[model samples]
Target: MESDYSSAKEQYAALGVDTDRAIQLLKKIPVSMHCWQGDDVGGFEHAGASLDGGGIQVTGNYPGKARSMEELRSDIEKTLSLTPGSYRLNVHANYADFSSTGFADRDALEPEHFKSWVQWSKENKVPLDFNSTLFSHPKASGLTLSSKDKGIRDFWIEHVKRCRKIGEYMGKEQGSACIHNIWIADGMKDIPVDRQGYREILASSLDDILSVKISKDYLKDSVESKVFGIGTESYVVGSHEFYMGYAVKNQMLLTIDMGHFHPTENVADKLSSVLMFVPEILLHLSRGVRWDSDHVTLFNDDMKAMAEEMVRTGKLDKIHIGTDYFDGSINRIGAWVIGQRATQKSLLRALLEPSEKLMSYENDGNYFARLALLEAEKTLPFGAVWNRYCEECSVPSDLQVIDEIMNYEKSVTALRG
Candidate 1:
């Protein structure tokens, strides 16, 4: 591996790509891993609270779904052991700990409910990101924050407010700004009549939620948008345009989910445009088979493109990266490791790119040279660097992770059933 990386290092050096520097930077870039994957979005809201829709679904009855918060953390920790580089845990409000006091509904959530989570974070040395749960609740069957009914809107608004406070507490404990992301399943399954009214209500709800200003030093707010969802096919209240306008106007970080748009449209293309408006943005990486299907993220063209754009723009600091896929069809720990490594690999490849040369070709108007160089660089010894990185990180390489996963399944998850 060392000899192979030596050769690759020489090759990348010719293209002005420093392999050492790339690995160092990649080590610092944290990909926030979602907690939902451990239990297929089944929060500890109740005994058997599994994935039930607001607009999404988690298929397959894969055994060993983390039945408790302890098991979920165990699974996540195992996943992190296999995944390389820095990481943060993305947690939802529904995963609150009610050890002392039985349970608190979303509207009544307090920071104390997440105290255990913060303690877990400190023990694991993993910072956290937060999301307000807007699905699988009784009130979320129809509109939530954008509902015509004032009670429904107020409930969700209060829930989000409480979530923000929880996020702030997590950040304060961890000493890093915890990103509080808001995504609501608010829209009609069929054609809607009052789009304008719903949007107005949503905007007002957002204003109310943001009215109580929290410490920006501790918590940063982000709003996620969807083009169409399962029950929100015809129209989505918080469309990309809506959040884009709102995020920029309100100076909040806008979240762009890879699977939230039409499949044909590349989310990577929007980074350059959106960054021009918002100061910073959050990326929810996922694979969308249909509409927001939320498949396990891979190092595919879409992900690579986004990572490349992120690297090319030299905006790594301005981007908050996180994986958001929940596939219950397979081993949950394997799912997390694969997706997290895929994201890491994508960013590493982009970091190893001959971006400067490509830019120079573009500037010189040598289109053929640009395209040819781009195509030729693909065959470079990237695998060697990746393997070397894995060795350095003390984790299994791609060829080795599979065996590790199978071993884990036999020893761990198989016993859950």
Candidate 2:
């Protein structure tokens, strides 16, 4: 079958990538949504501070100076105006609500709100991707299971059931309309010597929760195709390793967040392990510190190396661009877009460059160039209209949209040759 270049051009133009070739390149790229509430707990303190209780101290950042819905809508318009094809705007359930002790204090996610949000998102022509929907204990400080944490375990079990219920309901009605996002905030610190039981409990809960999918068949034959994602966290691993088992058990082929793994922990090996197990891996793109801290996408040399390795190893196929930006700022939106663009360009260059004797070891393969071409030909842009509204006032309009993207393309292409 002949590839229609005109259709491709139209599609790319819609997403803000102007060049016909760039659009064509972006056509095959998979884009997914990432969701987060600006803050999990609105100004408060952890009373008594149970291991699984909320322990946040009010840092005076509340009532987070956010933009009105109108501003957000305008940003959405701008985003869609650039990339007009099918893309996802990932969202979470707790953005406007609060939770305590592993329970969403808001009772249930209001049906009206969900419908309205989904409807509004579609009206803006942006598909919604729900993340952390099943993550029930946003208000909790840490999640664990022990004789001391039987309470936490009880909460964990109940939370899992609650999430399963939500998945079932949403699956029945609007499940197919959006992606079913999953990430675990369940882990504990200052553990007792008996770690075996802790691992068993967490792993069992995860298995049981995953089983909900099969029983409910949320992804079975829904009207809207649901995409499920699992995330990794640096804090998850320790000397004995509480998170390694959890990571190993994520057998489903889904999205992988780039910033979740830390370099101090051998990110390359962790990522490689995930890739090896999950045949179909979708990457969540973001930049983080190698030592500690997921401080947004300020590029680093180690990350460049990791990205280069992932691409060359054919892991780019399961990748999607994502920004784990927590701060409510217009700059966050811009940073997400710019960061992905810059990272893609830089990685493309690394992938495309011919074999050189720069490293101690080398592989005689054309895979790197091939991966670069694949990424260049098929990367998709996500529209973060809501984030823009939250941070629009503080951000400086440094460059024209076209100019920024063009520079991105040139930089990536220059690195390519």
Candidate 3:
């Protein structure tokens, strides 16, 4: 394997690409793994409550799903064992650890609600990122932040305020800036007579929620927009243009979820345009099939384009990549490992690109040469370098990881029943 990597290194070096540096850089880029994948996004908020609405759906009745916070953490650890490079755990507010005592409504949630998670992160050395749970609750039946009722809106606003405080606490405790992403399922099923009114209320609610200042070093705030959700096909309150304008004016990071946009839209192309106005952006990397259906990410062209765009623009540092898909139909642990590994592979391929050479060709008006080099680079020995990276990280590079996952399911998750 070492000799193969050496030979591949020589091949890449001919194109002015250093495979060793690419591996090291890929190791430094951490992909935030979403915690909800283990539990099918059925957060540990209220026992016996089904994940019915919220513009999100997890198909399949695959058993061995994590039923408790401890089990969820255990499954995540197992998944991380098979994945290469460093990573952060992304948690939703609904996943708060209140197992001992029943539950607290969203508005009354405190940092202590998530103290266990912070402690676990510290112990495991995995940094934490957070999202306010604005769906699946009774209050979220119609609207949340954009609700016409002042009381309902206030509840969500206060909940988000507390969530931001918790995000700050986690970042301070873990010694890294925790990104608090706000995504609400505030939209209408049919055409509303007052689209402007709802957006106005949403803007006001956001202002109130974000007014509670937290140091940027401790907590970075971001707002995510969606074109449409399950029951929100007609109108979505936080549309792309709405949040883009708000993010620019408020200087907040705009989060672009891969599954949130129209199917025809290439989210990779939007990164350079968004980054031109915003200092930094957050990405919710997910595969969208037909609509915003969060399918497990694959090593497809979309993934390649996203990675290539980041590399091409020289703005990899300006983006925070995070996985946001949940596939309950398959082994939950396998889903996490596969999605994360695919993302890493895409990044590795991107880093291996001969950007300097390609740019030189373009600068000399040699478009044909540039295109040829781009296409030729794809056939290079990226697989060898990826295997070498997995070896260095002490993880299985081939299908051997699948056997490990099967053993874990039989010995661990299967017994939960």
Worst 10 residues of 3 by lDDT: 47-56
Query: 164 in model 3: Cα distance from truth in Å?
Result: 0.4
Candidate 2 lDDT score relative to the true structure = 0.41
lDDT tens digits, residues 170-239, model 1? 9999999999999998888798889999999999999999999888889999999999888778999999
TM-score versus the correct structure, for each prediction: 0.99, 0.58, 0.98
- Residue 375's lDDT within candidate 2 is 53
- Error at 243, model 3, angstroms: 0.5
Residue-wise C-alpha lDDT for candidate 2, range 1-417, written one tens digit per residue: 013434544444553434433324443443553433223222111222111332212122323222333333343444333432235565555442222233234234443434544566557645555543323344344553222366655555554355445444444554443335445443334434545665566556556556654432353211111111122222231222333334445545444455554334445444566566544444555554443233445446555565666655665655444444343333323434454444444443344323232221234455665556445533432122211221222322224545643554344322323
Model 1 worst lDDT run, 10 consecutive residues: 50-59
- Provide the lowest-lDDT 10-residue window in model 2: 220-229
Evaluated at residue 66, the lDDT of candidate 3 is: 91
Candidate 1 global CA lDDT score: 0.91
lDDT per residue (tens digit) for residues 133-184 in model 3? 9988888888999998988889999999999999999999988899999999
